[model samples]
Target: MIIQLHGRRHLLDVDLDIDIEEFTSHVLFGPSGSGKTTLLRVLAGLDPLDEGELRVDGKVWTQGSAIKVPARKRDIGLLFQDHALFPNMSVEENVAYGIPRAKRGDKRGIIQWALTQARAQGFTSRPVASLSGGEAQRIAFARALARQPRMLLLDEPLSALDTPTRESLRNDLRLLIHTSGIPTISVTHDRTEALVLADQVVVLINGTVHQIAHPSTVFEQPADAQVAAAVGVETASAGSIVRRTNGLAEVEVEGARVFAPEPSFSTNGVLVCVRAEDIALAKEQSVTSQRNQLMGVVTRISPHGSLMRVDIDAGWNIASFITRTALDELELRQGSTVVAAFKAPSVHLIPHD
Candidate 1:
């Protein structure tokens, strides 16, 4: 399905032209209040169009000469963050509600099949309130899938659950949704979720799309510094490409020379990006196998559950993640002189905007 939005605005001018072709799953990712949910609502026919067009499978859903289809007749199943299940209804009844009344005789079989697909068959008779967080989420998915809609619209569907439960349900939901063979458009603020579940990712900011591409490409090669920073890669100080050698280039960052591998930027002014986890900490600089090395001092340390984030003060501030065991073994502390080593290939050169 291809979706094109032309000259549409709500409080701001939103002239977007997006093309999604044969994509079974897509993720609309952005920070809070970036219009991710608003875009989804517009696609689902829940929100009135100001001025634009939306087409699904070449069928005009919204346009100048065409009347918009009502939400109920759009053949789209929506799953919200809250699940929106009736508290008084049993799991089976909740799943069966979306089915046609004349086909009620097949509701039991359909409900059982849906539950099996969701791996919640044992909770068929339980009240919606009695189900655990994961169970309730699975039931909600089953209910949405029971209708056999042409497309699925999920608005931050797993955001309400706890971390562990959310992770588990993410895997389960991916499998179930793909097996149903319905194109899905999921809106989420979590980058990790978008990386794991989305086949294609669209980044929206302030009602505008910043970039749209595969997860790997987006992380490895961001469109600009804003996109790079959004994906957790720290921006480096402004520098000029001093020298270009055999598949490696040297740049001067604030009077300090840093080496990067085969950067695309040959101009004088450019910005670089390196992920925190890509940097390695060492007690001393070695000349053996490692290429890129810099001397820095540990300025701050933050705990990220299993990993520790160490902030280094070099020519430019750089962040690196290390295990707690490494932190204790090295006796790392503030003001300690540490060697920050990273692969030349890991440094990404992004065009400054």
Candidate 2:
């Protein structure tokens, strides 16, 4: 195992128990104040723990013995949101700065390799101030990789770029990082980035680790209502398990019958989550393979950049996503009667109080 934290307490009682293997990539994801950054700082040796043991690759980074390794000697690379390149240096020089004097003869080759990997090969001679936002961000990553550290730490690396640049750079960065075969722990609030890059995701909430799992599993089966809400599944409604058979469970939500798969709820007052994308909108009751269906009216339409969010009133408000083309084709407007259908496997059951 590459990382282990035990008996830790800071702001909250953080008794984190996780074991990640080397060369595995994962994301520390949560809301702004969810301690994602704090956990990274702890791993980077920037924060002191009240009580815990931290081991990286079997080397004790921290423990009750008061033996804590310093950040500089940890041989970890960090890429911050802001590209903190020196204004006076060129891109190539910035990356070369991290190369030790013993390897100074190979500085040109190292810089070339880093720039090629980042797809910033042509911008090497450009002054730091002369490069575009995306170019500078790539150079920052190049500098970090120039050190060839065992682990890399990233803090919202794509948050500063524009949408187009962010998208392109996200793909390039993921390819480069995986090719390097180094264990990486990245912190990001962006769900798309987490889904695209992480093999596993660690959700932090209020100085504690809430749940850790694969990206698909985390989104499909959130550990609780709070975690579900954090990931954009926000509607919380009471329901009861009416029947269970054939790997499916019938849930009655406010007198409406909805089918879900393998629902573990045994009593009343259970909360269930259904993603907006999972809910499909239709003009009438149509024959399909989907198991859950409800009659609803279009209550509101919200435009979200490239997507349209349709709010349906089905005894309770249910949100659904539709493409602009689909919305226009359906001629969907306020007060339109629509049928909301979703697969039984997509409706997730969250623990209810």
Candidate 3:
């Protein structure tokens, strides 16, 4: 399906053209207040566009001041951050409530099918109040499926749960949505979620579309500096290509030399982008195959989820993510000296104009 949406909302001025393959998941990803949810809501018909047009599959859904189709007739199922299940209702009742009046004739069949699809059939008779966060989310998903929507809009589907529960539900949700054959658009600020759930990722920042590509491309080869920062390229610095040999380019950033694959573009200025996870920390300079090694002092160390984010300063700032075990073994501290090593291929160079 093809969607062309152009409009303005509170803190949002968007112009997007998207093509979604049938049964594939598209992710709207960006930092907070980047208008990810706003775009999703507009597409769901929850809000009106100030001045623009929305067309789906060559059909106009909205014009400058007119809405051709209202929210109820859009055939979309939306799941919010909160599951929004009724506390007084049973799991079965909650799922049944989402069934349209036309489909209530086969209520039992529809409910059972949706619950089974969402893997929530076992809790059909359980009280909503007694269910866990993950269970409640599953019930909400089951309800959404009962509608048999042509499109699904999920706004932070797993954000309300704890880390472990979120991770587990993320996997289940991806499989359920794909197998159900429903095209989905999910909004998230979590990089891991975008990487795992999205067949295509739309990176929005400050209410603008910065990049649209596969998750790997968006994270590994950002289109520009804004997308690099939005997608969390932890170690990015302004540099210039000082020399090129064979297929390798040597870049200089604040007196520090970094080697990377040559860019296809003909340019001397570049922005070196490297993920924190790609950098390796060592207590001593070891002879390895890594093409780039910088001797730096540990400036700071902070907890990053299950890992540690170590900040170093060789001639410029750099960051690396390492496990706690490695931190302790390396004896890293605020003043410890260490070697940061990364292969040349790990460095992604974006042409800077």
Candidate 4:
């Protein structure tokens, strides 16, 4: 589906234009109050559409030319963070509520398909009030699918679940949406969700579209320092271009002359962005072919999911993500002497004023 939309919302201070083609799922990601939900709500036509032209699958839904289609006529399904299920209704009835009467002739079949696809089977007769957070969420997803929408808009649908449930259900949701053959736009603030589910990712910041690209591109090579931090490239250090040769930059950072990828601008100063995962930690000052390396003492070791985050201070602190096995092999601990090494291309240089 192809969409072109532009609008301004005064109260929210949102003014922007975005065009996207979602043959698969796209994640609209940003921090809270960053207009992620506003964009989703506008696309779903749940509220005022913020004065823009919205076209889907070659049909004009809105042109601001007296050609506005109401929400129901847009052939879209929407899910909210809260599920919005009827407290008094059973799961089946709640799912059926989203199916319009005109389409009710085969409603049972559609509801069953949705429930099965959502992994919500055997809970059709269960009361909404008695369901777990994850169970209720599956019902909500089934309700959205009951409409047989051409496009789906989800606003932080998995945010309400506990950590373990959210992670597990994320894969399920990704598989369900990909197999359903519908273009989807899901709003989220979690980068991990975007990484796992999005075929494309739109990074919105402070009511503006900051960057839009593949999850890997946006994460590995963010447009700026702010976007870098958002994608978990937690290492940002002040640096200066001592020299540029052969498209490589020699950046002097905190008394260490490190090499990194050259910047587009010929600025002398920059904020060097190094993803923790891209940086590797080793015991002692090892010799390596990597362009950037520094000898430092391990200052902290922290647990992150199944991986370990080791912080090293060689005058300047650097962080790296490695497997627990690697950490144990290296015997990494606070105050242990180590070296952090990364390739030149792994360092993203953001020019500073």
Ranking 1 against 3 by TM-score, winner: 3
Q: Residues 171-252, candidate 3: write the lDDT tens digits.
A: 8888998998888999999999999899999998999898989899999999989999988899889999999999999999
Ranking by TM-score: 3, 2, 1, 4
Highest-TM-score candidate = 3
What total of clashing residue pairs does each candidate reach?
Answer: 0, 0, 0, 0
**Stretches of model 4 off by over 4 angstroms after superposition:** 10-21, 49-67, 323-333
Instruction: Give the Cα lDDT of each candidate.
Output: 0.79, 0.80, 0.89, 0.81
Q: Which ten residues in a row have the lowest lDDT in candidate 2?
A: 6-15
lDDT of 2 by residue, 168-223 (tens): 98888788778877778889888899888888898877777778999888887888
lDDT of 1 by residue, 1-353 (tens): 56666535473235555554356788888878878887888777777556667676567776743437878888788998888888988788899989867767888888888788778888777778888878887888888888887788999989999999999888877887788878898999888888877888887777778888998888777777767766767545567778888988887776567778766655656677788888889898987555778898999999976899999988778888999998888789999999988887777776553
lDDT of 3: 0.89
Model 1 residue 205 distance off true place after TM-score fit, in angstroms: 1.8
Off by over 4 Å in 2: 7-13, 17-23, 63-67, 264-269
How does candidate 1 score on lDDT?
0.79
Q: Choose the strongest candidate by lDDT.
A: 3
Please provide TM-scores, in order, for all candidate models, with all chains considered together.
Answer: 0.91, 0.92, 0.92, 0.88
Give candidate 4's error at residue 346 in angstroms: 1.5
Query: Candidate 4 lDDT, tens digit per residue, 226-250?
Result: 7876776878888889999998999
Candidate 3 weakest lDDT stretch, 10 residues? 14-23
